[model samples]
Target: MAAGDIIPVHLYLCPLTLPGLSSDQQGRLLDTLPLDEQQKVMRYRMASAREKGLLVRCYLRALLSKAHTQLNQSSLNQSPLNQSQLNADIDGAIGPSEWRFDYLDKGKPVLSKAFFARSQLVFNLSHSGDYMLLAIAKSPRLELGVDIERLRQNTNIHAILNHYFTRQEREAMLALPSTRQRERFFDLWALKESYIKAKGLGLALSLKSFYFELSETECQALSFKGLDARQARLEQAARLFLVKEDSQQTDLGNDPQQAQPAAGWQSKLWQLDDEYRFALSLSSTDPLDLRCEMVSAQALLSE
Candidate 1:
């Protein structure tokens, strides 16, 4: 696929936890980046890997299969490949079935502005301690970001608030009852994290600058800072979903008819069944009932 082509992700939850993952690029993506960038990527990667690494890998492989169908088999046959660089090279070709860019540093020696700016395609990989969330969308659909945290320990919600929450957000968070507020607080945090991740511009964009309509009930996007965050709005493209694997919510394996191909994620909020708190953003497209396809990370793997 050309860099400008439409490449949307279909998210998934890996069944493996962070500690459960142990192979290749299955659990550790941060190591590929520069040391400085590692911390930021580590900020999120460690969470997913620590919590949902295994499941994330399973789900990601499933998502890749979906993209694989769209690939021209003949073209794939003609491309030169090396088994050792299989994953990296194929990633260079088809991009991600589910990939992301937010924490990518522009000044880093390993990553370039052009690399993260592959404007047409974007996907997200997130995990806490037990569940990994994978989301895919067109660059035009929704600029999306996501963070998964294990529901462990004290969660230290209060301390983190001082670092990222704006005055208004902090007030809004505190105004609610403690129990309910904690849950809502996380949703809002995930929403903001997801927003930043999708922006791909990283910390240069202030967390408080863009105000997200994050409620337990809905997902909304608004730029409060009037910063350049506006361009991050992915226009026209839709966020569609297909199930390559099953989770807690729906069961597609029972219905063969459900496995039909989809036009795109036009407008629909379908659940894939992993319950570690998953949400999606669509740019704006019509909804269509399509079958979920599977793309192999191995498909991207060079022969």
Candidate 2:
């Protein structure tokens, strides 16, 4: 990626196969939802969100069901409180983080607000085409955002960029060599969007305020708008990062400031399993020491 680029830090792929859950398995799961979550499900019952939410909840319950069996020969047909206690030791270690499902959480996740209503693990999730975009915080309790979109070859680049992007950004694309169509456009589009999501201020930031410049190895971001320039005071990205020979600027997730001009945000793009193109983003004061792991919903299931 060119400077001010949003590079993907890691990629995790899980199998789709899941063992069917029995009635006892399903019941044990819903019984763990907090009062508010239960009420929210009740309010949105029968909706797609409700269905997806329940599916994820059941996935968690299944994991716990297995765990319960291992810890003791306890049947999962117990009261909710008992199940919670029996699974306490496992929950403490595995916890909500293991489940990592945000298929129905609000905007960007706030640890406390989304998972269990007030925890602070800070992550965001979105899925497009056949992939999911997961933006996670390494630490420092920062706000994070990420997106993964498929390359629709026939997309009208001029139109979409004209509408969502500032004039200069569009010009950069037009001025590019005819050979750099799909890759360049997607890189710029992702960087612009990922930056907006990171700010958490939504569309309030204008595309013209910043520009992502492309270089041989990476992209760099520069702030044209005073608002974005001032954002540096908060250590937010006003530019992007491409890659280089040195490793001093490795983990942008924890130390985003390492990204400099002539190379925009530091992000990684990977072709995974021949099914999708993936980009993961992280913003931190320093490059994050991310412990990347690939786990299935089954791995997180309770005994």
Candidate 3:
């Protein structure tokens, strides 16, 4: 949480089934959003979708505000400042309306320069079925992307694999026992989504251009049902191979070592529940310190 210091990646998972906000609570949260965002939330045709959108946005703002306050306090504490001045500054938390964002060409949103200048806070969010996840970090050099998928039996696994996965990846996945193929499918899908999202290129970066190679060790690690927040360590689960722009094949052959490792990038995968798989990708050369928490809607609003 200290300014200019690398901090653990903090993951917050909120369930959509939490009690709905009262009208007053909804109004107060809506008031903090920009007009455009407010309209976007309201424009959702389905009431459930609208509520989900509103909750995510408000929870994100609340988390950002808390982080900003901590960063501000840290900076002030490191400087030669009177206790009263520090208290005053810390008390003046960044308001939700004060946050500004800019989107990349493919629509990944980032903090505007004005806010980013204070502290290099970065975050990414994903939602699936009944859950929403937010991953945040506080280092200038860190980039984060997180994905949560509700595994569904009806997914057209072969069609998607043929279209988006590299030849080797498809072969490797299909080689798995029939009983495990569906779980493996979601695992790779979540990992690919996380990588592209972390790169901030969205689907513009072809999924077929790169593939994940989980070592025997990594595969064993991924088998665990849940991650202990204190022991969550991101390892190099995949290597990136850039294909020739005009070529559709990955060309890495059978040996993954033939391709260069994705430097400064780390990833971790976890089975969140019987129906969900989660993946996180981050750009960081240092070892990761990660914390995962399940937060309630009331807790988020109280903060």
Candidate 4:
């Protein structure tokens, strides 16, 4: 989106389906991508992983194509869609130069160039079990991250809680009834992962250093206890983002350059289906207008 556009957060979920997408169709999708991406997809040994990678990239391109078109339409004061032009733009497609991506030192990918100097567009992706999730925001000034996980019964829950959670967090989770404990574990893990992804530090930010305390009304971020000063500083700087309902209380006085904890960070936990949990973390100076959309593998790969 253009600079300062307040586009809704786009969350896409695609199931892993092998039908409909023929070998040639798959090849065509791969052909549209840069050679490096093609090589990476080709390198995946697992069939599901390879296909998931392919579909995720293509779906992202389609969404970007749509976003770019909308951005231009707004600038020209045009209607949301000029059907003919919109279809052509979606199908003909633009090259990747406009949206080339580069990763942070910690492996979080970011847009390398904005359509306008002030564009705030940012996005993040996560995949698990039967679905892959991609979160995109229209603003260039916002930090965005998303994570999805399918419930799994095989993991050692006690070990995970002990290893990754704070003593307080572990106790809190364990206090839940056994049936709900698993769900809570995944919920907390997704929250932490989403925050790390939003910060663009990935796992370089220690999981154990910070924790999210959940309640019916709000999720509180506990003071971080990192091993060193830098992690400690980051933890101290982390602020829970404000939602649309909480916007009136926000004070926009913090200096972005100071790396302070008051940086607006809004988070939400979602239940995609009975089997999956999703979490979103965004760093924006204002409240987040989050939205989610689900698509099947067929819809994503369709002509």
Candidate 5:
């Protein structure tokens, strides 16, 4: 495949607290959203929950608008049409507030067909604790999902594993030392959620139908500071597997080789902070090049 055919995924992490927007700015930002989105934001019972919802939607619109502009500019450069026509096309481009959305039967939102034709962008949104994560890829062929979880000491890890996880997955976590079990639980949960979200099946797909085999791999040293620097120590490479009950030979620790890899899917896990675990899944057979950056509330809103 040519270089242009390969999909590139972009991750934007926005913290809800840093450089918080004022009341007036917040109202104006809310006003920019579509009616349904504004109502959705209002439905959040708690102030914090409402703020997170607002930021995620607004940032999504800003990013989509930017993507649309870049796509248009790229096409304009290649078109034989004169500058006058190009200028007219640029003026006709849709704004963030004007964008439309459609949702899958399972509640995963996607760009409406009208706007999708102009830019074949696919995106997924997730939030946990004080941060919201947005994953975007610019190809109709690509599907993307991202999830973040803040590690907490009060979670009932064993009960959850027993109910939702595959036998192999449960055994792997149980075998771990008690001190590490919580972290391991969140790791698996984030990965599984990302996979389901990527598939757009939500909880309609049984969690036991699939499992992930996570193993440590050496990652490249990060030259940049801040989040990337912390990621150097926390990121672990993982592979996805499907449960084949009839075969009955899948073992968590002893015989990983017997498991079947889930083809055309790729996932990565990262420790964004001391308290948060993040994972991303993409439907692509090609090598993945995922770029991540932390964007502040001010920066995202200003864009």
Candidate 6:
């Protein structure tokens, strides 16, 4: 992959609580979804989760509508509805018929053959605490995966890291002089989780298969002695390793199939707020030009 070939990614973040939307207004947003999605929203056992689900779908529909309209402009032009009418029906522009989903063997979601074949877009959704994140990659599906976690104090960082992290990693973490060991632990966890999510295998893959070395200004993935070097080579060739303070080569493992082969894969981390850390993995070797936007309450709850 060309180092200068930048891949543009759109990331939308919506706070769980909207500024002016009421319970009734939120219900109306849920109504805009097709029955299946509505059922999914209603099935949530907790009110907070249910509201977050509803808002996510609303944001998703808005994103989908914008993307689909841009892709099929000719069809929109041929429609009887005028521009004003089309704008007014934004929620219904790409209706239920145009959307489709399938699942990976391990249950990670994927776009159906027909839908992706037409739009070539891939998206991943993640929510934690008070925020919901939706990521979209344009044509030539990026096979993206995103994750966010609120930094909480209850996690047993040392114990969990000792159990799951590689010896080298454990040593590194232990060696850190900073008192923020817990924060560092979550940073590693977020990156690892996002990497696996991007692979679409979730936690089914062994944590020992890969380990990361993270610092304030550098991040790198290192392979074990017996690890599959071929996978490492593929990651290097794709240039999908973590960011560093300077340009340097990174190693991968033997399994190319772990990530989207054609598109390769890349991972990123961002501290979105004081209490949350966000991680993103994308199936692209090109440098990521991630565009993060905060969706307004009015835009999401509007017709």
Candidate 4 deviant stretches above 4 angstroms: 1-7, 18-20, 71-98, 114-119, 217-263, 299-303
10 residues in a row with least lDDT, candidate 3: 222-231
Residues 1-303 of candidate 2 have per-residue lDDT tens digits of 233322222223322334554556445555666655556655665554443454444433343333323323222233345656757634543343233334322254344334433222345544555333444432333545555556667887766775565444466577778766555577666666666566565666555454455445333221212211210011123244432234232322223343334322344344332333444444543353332333354443443
Error of 3 at 179 (Å): 1.4
Off by over 4 Å in 3: 1-6, 71-92, 216-252, 255-258
Positional deviation of residue 149's Cα in model 3 after best superposition, in angstroms: 1.1
After superposition, candidate 6 runs with Cα above 4 Å error: 1-4, 19-23, 68-98, 218-264
Mind giving the per-residue lDDT tens digits that candidate 3 earns over 137-227? 8777677899989999888888887788877777878899998788778888888888888999988888877777764444333222123
| Candidate closest to the true structure, highest lDDT | 5
TM-score of 1: 0.47
- List TM-scores for all candidates, in order: 0.47, 0.52, 0.83, 0.73, 0.85, 0.72
* lDDT value for model 2: 0.44
What's the lDDT for residue 130 in model 4?
69
* Candidate 2 Cα errors over 4 Å, as ranges: 1-94, 97-107, 113-120, 176-179, 218-275, 280-285, 300-303
Candidate that scores best on TM-score? 5
How much is 239 displaced in model 4, in angstroms? 9.0
List the lowest-lDDT window of 10 residues for candidate 2: 226-235
Mind giving the per-residue lDDT tens digits that candidate 5 earns over 1-303? 243355556677777765556788789889999888999999999877778888888888887786567656766776788879988878967788888899999999999998888677888989888877788777777778889888988888877876778777787788989988889899999999999999999888778778887887775442212342334244577889976664343333335564578977888888765788788888777765565566666755565
Candidate 6: global Cα-lDDT? 0.63
Residue 213 error for model 5, in Å? 0.3
TM-score ranking of the models: 5, 3, 4, 6, 2, 1
Note the residue pairs that clash in candidate 3.
Answer: none
Model 1, span 1-303: residue lDDT tens: 343344434444343422333356543443433454344444555644433323343345445444343432323466766675556545654333333323456321111235334434356666555445566544344455445544434678898876666554577678889875666566556556554555566677566454333324343332212111121121212222233333213322234343333233223222222223434543334331222232223322322
